[model samples]
Target: MRAFLPLIALATPLALGACGDPAPTYIDQAWIRLSPNKDTPSAGYFVAHGGDAATRLRGVLTDYALKVEMHESMSEGSGKGAMMTMKPLDSVDIPAKSTVAFAPGGKHLMLWGVNDTAISRGKMTLTFLLANGDRLLVDAIIQKPGADAPAPKADEHKDH
Candidate 1:
């Protein structure tokens, strides 16, 4: 019985560790680049960290913006003939233990008619919907047009 007690103690910790929560899936470094033109939709970017299980980024929602859509930029041709094109994406897959970036020239969010309140606050809350039934709320820093804006890239706002 004493020997069995030692075995049970060792097994207890292993069982607890196995039952621990899975690695967390989350989003961070979120920001929005306001367009130089009010009529043009602004762009949003962020980085998503995958958890123990694979999932998909279904969409983003924000009360500050009238509309939000996920988009991807692609080059259709090669070399000098290369032309950039943008397409809306319904969902983006995120592999387990991986990172996905929504950057200036890659996947991004287009926001139209951002409310004045959010602009004044210089930040806004965004809700990220994941296929794994996770809703992550993150605050995105807002960058208004001018010198502090992100570096200008030809493909960044071609669609807007």
Candidate 2:
């Protein structure tokens, strides 16, 4: 009974795994919330995945602003409410089987001159320039600061 149980456990997994499952497709169109500030530029965050091999981000650009720069946020000062300073990043790399997270109060995309229009319901296209010169376009949805907005549904995104 003991030997039979071990074989069942191992064989079950192997048999199920042999169903010819395709490799996972890389996740695209990831994002981060854009926190608001009176004196600072707006930031956009997201994750860039490198599915099978290493990837490097050379730059990012968007028509919504004069320039798009990669920046990292660092916490300084004392106490629990330590002030954070966002510093510019030269470049970013996503190693093989890895991802680069762009989140609030962390490494984010710095957008300058956000335009006069409201961000509550507008679409912005962010072009990510990779080290290999491959540019990926992701449509970023804008929302009000402090409002919790869930991710878009699958039906909203269909291959055209």
Q: Give the candidate number with the greatest TM-score.
A: 1
Give candidate 1 misplaced runs (Cα > 4 Å). Answer: 3-19, 146-160
**Steric collisions counted per model:** 0, 1
Supply the TM-score for candidate 1.
Answer: 0.84
Q: What lDDT is obtained when candidate 2 is compared to the true structure?
A: 0.68
Which numbered prediction scores highest in lDDT against the true structure? Answer: 1
1-160: candidate 1 lDDT, tens digit per residue: 9989999999999999888788878887788999999999999998888888899999999999999999999999999999999999999999998889998789999999998999999999999999989899998889987535444345532321
| TM-score list, all predictions | 0.84, 0.66
